[model samples]
Structure formats: structure tokens, C-alpha cells
Target chain A: MRWNYLIAGATAAIVGSTSGHATTYMTPAQARVAMFPSAASFIDRNVVLTPQQRSVVQKIAGIPVRAPKIMAWEAVDAAGKRLGWVIVDRVLGKHEFVTFALALDAGGAIKGIEVLDYRETYGDQIRNLKWRAQFTGKRHGATLQLDKDIKNISGATLSCRHVTDGVKRLLATYDAVLSDHG
Target chain B: MVLSDCLPPMMPSFQIMGELERRCRPLLGTFVEITAPHEKAIAAGFATIVKVQSLLSAHDPVSELSAVNRLGHRRSVTVDPWTAEVLQRALFWAEASCGAFDPTLGGLMAARGLLARNDSLLPLDPQANWRDVHVTNREVWLDRPLRLDLGGIAKGFAVDCAIDAMRAVGVQCGLVNAGGDIKGFGPEAWPVTIAMPGSREPLAMVELQNAALATSAGHDASGGLDMRHLAGASPAIASVTVEAASAMDTDALTKILVSATLKSVVCLGLAGASALTIFVDGRVIPFELKEPTA
Candidate 1:
């Protein structure tokens, strides 16, 4: 249940951010505590899937397993009673990377999900001064502010389809691997 | 030793600066991001958005909006004050635009497979329009069986509510963006970029100060524009971006401009909003209302 390493890793990740678009919403430890406030302990139950297990997961999830390793934690109460499980996973958005934590209750139903990090890979192109200069003082007659980062965008809404699909895959992971665990 | 060597090494500071905090979560079928100076403010903002979604989401059968849709034709369904307020605004825009921005198109959207159809609900009346909806106090009643989808304006209302939540927490400046609908308020201007429909290409950049901005695009599958929410919209227009004092107005105005009837200009003037429309042929038009003479 010690969370020193988790705090350290989170600090390192935040300090390493050079791009403005990458946002870290919560540390792994923070997310665990938020998802399971009553848990007395969190046991690291990270899994490494066998080839057969991977295929099973892919079949159940209807999505290809991108990796064999999965980061997971098992929550236990003060009386050593099993509470739930938390699975950390990553999925690619259309032009971004989303890292999220999906929590499942003891009955294998989804408790909640939280986004840990969101990084827009396309952010750099818009930040380019040359690319932005083309629209400067254009026919739109709106004042173009060039020096600031494109922190907010107003355009067609982007669906959270990737994250939803990622949740489905993680749920299948639960049904395939963690469902039978003690 | 050089002058720089005599001084300390000019390395970038690695310490965390406690000035700004940003968070993003999936809500209202899209990612809602909030940026504020304090963590509590951001949390409050997201909490408010969650409440609004629970009350107004048509996708959730247990929500008040779904309840109204399921039984409004038969009985007066009571809704939360916030839901009633948004419904009132929707009616206002619907009236101003002369059916160009109808909220009763939910039946058409369901028929088109844009929204899930509930078999248990009463049969929809194709003749139902915004005029069929009646709102008095917190009660909403439909003159006929018409599914009401607030998808066109609810996100903006959520954004506005989130901003108010942030302000309640003593947040001086903050921004709330639900998908592409955004509102920012503070002393300094928030810089935002406008992307082309279905692409990340930068179309324009504008500074929003204590204002709201929203963009609506035509049916472009690749662009991720859910044109199903719009009624009688012209597909020839690529996109329309509106700016107003409130996010709800901006959000509804974008849809009004996309439909583009003669009354839309009057709606823009009455709402104190302006719009920028990008045509499919790459023509950009700005609609600025003339000042009324005293």
C-alpha cells in the first residue's frame, strides 16, 4: 500500500513535460485513493498475458491486444476483504494520446473511469508560428493572437470513441484475466 | 571563465509551479476540459457539468429530459430549475429562428438512426415542432408526442454552468470547453484556435475575453461533426462559429447560422451575437449586426 514510488513517478512525469498540450490530471496514487477511499490496501497485481490469454482478450474485447503487459491493482479493505480492481491503460485518440484508469467493482461491473493524461500530438503543428501566420489578419476580421499556445479550440466536437473502446477492452481484460483471481 | 560560466548554469526550473491546474474528463459524449488557478475550482466546475448532464442528457433514460420525452405528451413532467431554464432558452432560439433551430427534431434524428429509439415511448408526431413545447415554471409539456433532444444547446449550457461554479469558488479567471464549445472569463483574454472541419488545420485564431465561442459544422463524418442535431441545416456551409456573452447563446447561434434563414440575421442581432461562416468553396463570411438607431 506504500505510495512513495507512485508519487515520485508522477512528479517525474510532470517535470518532464515540455509540450504545452500534454496535461496530467491525476497521479496514479491519487486516482487510486479517489476511486477507492475506503480501501485499506492496494496490492499490485500487474499481469503479463500469455499468447493464448492475449487471443482470448482480443476475441472478447473485439479489439487487438496491443501489448501483453497490463498494469493493475487490487483493492482490499481493512478486514482483508476484496473490494475491486483498477486497471491503467492507454488508448490513441484520433490525434492525441489518452491514458486512463478504469475501476471495476467486485461484481465485475465498471465503477468509474478517470483520464490520467491527455496529450495532443497535433498540437505542435498549430503551435508552429509559420503555420499560424497564414491566417493572421485574414478575411474573418477577428484579431489573431499568435504568441499564446492553442490551449482551447472551438471547432467540431471530437467524440470520445477511443476512450470508450479502450474501456470495453479493459472490461474484457477483467472478464478474461482478473475475474477468477482471489 | 566566460560571463555565463561565472554565473550559475541556466537550466530550466524543474519545480512545480502552483499557478494553474487543468483537467479533462469524458462528459456529454465528448471531453470536457477545465482550466483554473485552483484545483477546487476545477473540481467544482466538473461537478456542475456532471449535474447538468444528469438532468439534461437524453441518452440516459432516467434523466429528467428522457422522462419528459417519454411522457410529456400525456402529462406535465416537472424538471429541475436548471433544465427548465435551458428549455426556455432553447424555445427562445427556436422561436427567433422560425423553426430553423427546432428542439423537436429528436424524432427525425431517431428515425435517421442518429439517436437511439425507445420502443416503449409513444409514437412520434411528425408534425410536432418547437411550437408544441410549453414550459411554465419547472414543468414542461408537449402538445404531441415529440422527442426533445437538447444536444444542440445543452453542452453550451453546461459550460456556462461550469463557469458559474468556478466563479462561486472565487476563481477569478477560468475556461471550460465541452468538446469544441468553449467559454472563458477573467481579466486577460484566452487565446483559442479554430480548426477546419474534420481536420486539424488551423482556420483562424481569436482571443476570447469574458465571452463564449462555439462552432457548428455540416455533416462531415471524418470531421466528427454530428450534424444530426441540426434541423434543416444547409450542408453547403462547412462551418459556422459564433461569439457571444454567454456560451448558451453562442452554441445556439451557431446552429441558427448553419440553417441560415432570413430570420437568422434578426436572431443574431437580438441575441447580441456575431458569426463567421466558412463555405464549402472556401469563402469566409462574417455577419456583424448593425447598431440600432435610437
Candidate 2:
């Protein structure tokens, strides 16, 4: 392995600039149309969780409820037939924020999910101790520049665990409130 | 002046960039993002990825790869042409790397609990290697009972397939990124940033033009060198990144470079790829392939 490492000074020059920018993949309206193309229209059916409903959602989801309000819409065909529901939610990580839309059939089964926007932000103080513990052996915690031009990232695959967890919580929200609202 | 008048007039000497459409969806146990000039092109690219995932995923019990592992020892099983193509390419790498990049490490992966065991299949053969598996046209069979995992290479193949799908739709420029196995082709270069292992810190930046780049790293959580996909080799480096013409080659090459030998160097040369090994101490080393003697 040592013989293979002939140090070359050909590494690409690092651009020095820092700007916080979120990559918006889709909007809620676009996502609604994309997830349910056949639906004629969407009806706003946003919900605000009561204290009891929040507790129920937390119990069912196995994750805490960060917000009481949830943005959602009901997709109906031309003849007033219910196509499905679209729920928009956001998952906040220590360094990332992911806003996504989840679509479910009338029976609450997941139809599809589309990420609306993904933002990675760095703070002065890292809050997640457990996540930080993974890199305790590093000599330095290098500061990353969240540049808009750098669109692609290559490295150890970042786990979408937060989004997965967020999906589970949204499902619980559906069971707790949206399921019996008809 | 007369000769200049014969040429077509220059229209501002500026090109209008197309409106890029981007979308991300959860697929293949990860987020698959596709960016193209049109919505239809992006949709087609994603559909191709979804198809590849359905055909090649080892986590799905009904996937063609799972079927091959479950019953290939009993009888030859025919798979989709896409699956066959991926399998043939995998076998080629397995031979080129001299078992260094074997696909038959699924048994070990299952034993390590990295892969779920399918109870319906017979007990795994401890000595099973790539040699035990044979591919004849679209039919595949195993000489002994052994699992097959395409987790390392399938994601890259999916990215490549998605690129092909977008190109088929007359898309001249596009990018498909499946959990960091990135491939982009356009009139201009795509800038990519490499993140440090276990953290979101940018380690290096590389510009990709009509090529793919893949990075494989260990997840020891202690910043130690430990990879789950390696069968019997102990990799000294923390991460390996390969840039090649195709995502599939780059993906497989990253694994082969984990414990690269002189033979692997020749293999890299043959594949027209270059590699960079980043140490645990944050040192990035590029491979220097010496030309063979006449």
C-alpha cells in the first residue's frame, strides 16, 4: 500500500468561499402533482396536534413531536373521489434539515416520498454529542464550506436515517389524527 | 472582407443553459438524486434506477440476486438481461482482481450479520468463492450453496443505467447520484466535494467531466480502519476513492483498492482508472501507476 502512494501535487485547488444555501429539489405543489398525477385537485387539510394527540403520535412513532402543526393536502379526482393524502414535514438533524412530502393512500399505506429541500448547516457549537463521538480520534474537525456550486458529494454514504425516522413519525401522525378525519 | 462575409454571423457568442430539473427519492435503501435539463429526462433516469434496484438489490427477498442465491445451487435460474449484464461485469472484475473483489463474499457477509440470511436456502458453503458461480448467457447457477451480494457494485451500475436512460431520452447533459456514487456528463465539468469519513467536513474537491467517482470508507465509529464489505483482506487505509469512466468500474475499484496489491495496480491501469487513498491521519495519497517494461 505504501508503494502506491506517490504523493502528487495535482490535487484540485480548494475554492475558499462559504455560503449557506439549501438545494431545493421540488416544491410542495410540484411534489403533489408528481406524486399523484391523476388527481384533479388538492384540498388543504392541514392539522394542528393537540397535547393528547401529540402524546399519542410520540407514543406511536417512537420519536418526539417537534411541531404541533402539520401541513397536508387531500388529493381528489374530478368526480370528488379521494385519491390520497400528501403530508409535508421537515426533519432536523444536528447539521442538516430535510423538508419532504409523503404521500399515502386512503388506507394510510405509503405511496411515495419526495424530498422538497435539503439543507446542511454548520453551527458554532455541534449539538449532537453522540454523532460527534464518532470522530473523536480525528486530529481536527475541519470546517466545511456549503457552497452552491458543489452540487455532488462523494464519501462514506451518508445515512438517510433521519428521513426514515421522520417518515415513521408522519405515519404515526396519520394514524393518530388524519385517519379518522373523514 | 468578402471571405468573412461568407461565414455565419456570431449570435452574441454565448450559449443559453437549459433549465435543470432535479428530484430526489428514497430508493435502493438510500436517496437517489437525478438532475437533467427536462422533467421527463429526470423521470426517465429515476425510473431506470428503480428498475435496477428491483432487479439487483440483495436486501429484497424477491430480487433476482436473491433468487440466484436461494436456488442457483439446485438449478439454473434465468434473470433479466440487466441482471445478467451486471453479473457478467461483476464476474469480470472478480477475475481481474484475482478474488480481491469477489462477489461470493455474501456468505461471510451474512455470517457477520451484515446481510440477512434467507432461511429457505441451504447452509452456506464455507469455501465458496467466485469460481463456484457460473454464468451461461442469461442463466446463472452455483456449484454449491452460497449467497451473492451485489451491494458494492449494483449502485454504480444503477447510476450508469440511469445515465443511459436519460441519454436515450435525448438528454445531452445529466447527473445521477445514488448515495455518493456520482456520475455526471455535460458541456461543463461538475464540481464534487469529498466529505471526511464519519463527518460532513469537506476533505477534497474534484471536478468530474464525463466520468464517475466513488468512495468507500470504514464505519468503525472510532475512526479506525474497518470495512464490512471486505472478505478476507485487512485494509490499511481509511478510505479509497476511484475516478473512472463508468460508475460500475469506479465502485468495484474502490473495493479492490482497499487492500490493493501490485496486481490491483495493473488492474487499475487496465480499467483506465486512478485512485486516491486517504489515511486515518487525513493524508490523501494518489496512486502512481508505473508503465510496464517493454
What TM-score fits each model?
0.81, 0.82
Q: lDDT tens string, model 1, B1-294?
A: 011212222221212224667778888888898989987898899899999999998888899999999889999998899999999999999998887887887878888776789888888888889999999878999999989999899999999999999999997789899988999888776767676665444455566778899998732444334566577778677789888888998888888889878987788777677777877655556666666211
User: What lDDT score goes with residue B62 in model 2?
Assistant: 83
Worst 10 residues of 1 chain A by lDDT: A1-10
lDDT of 2 by residue, A1-182 (tens): 11111011211112222232357888899999999999999999999999999999999999999999999999999999998999999998645688999999978899988889987653222222343333344322223334534467787765576888999999999988888762
DockQ for the candidates, in order: 0.22, 0.28
What are the per-residue Cα lDDT tens digits for candidate 1 across A1-111?
000001122222222334435567888787888788999999998988889988998998899888789899999999999999999999987667889898889888888
Candidate 2's clash total is 0
Quote model 1's TM-score for chain B: 0.90
Evaluate candidate 1 by giving its C-alpha RMSD to the native, one decimal: 9.9
TM-score of A-chain in each prediction?
0.76, 0.76
lDDT of each: 0.76, 0.75
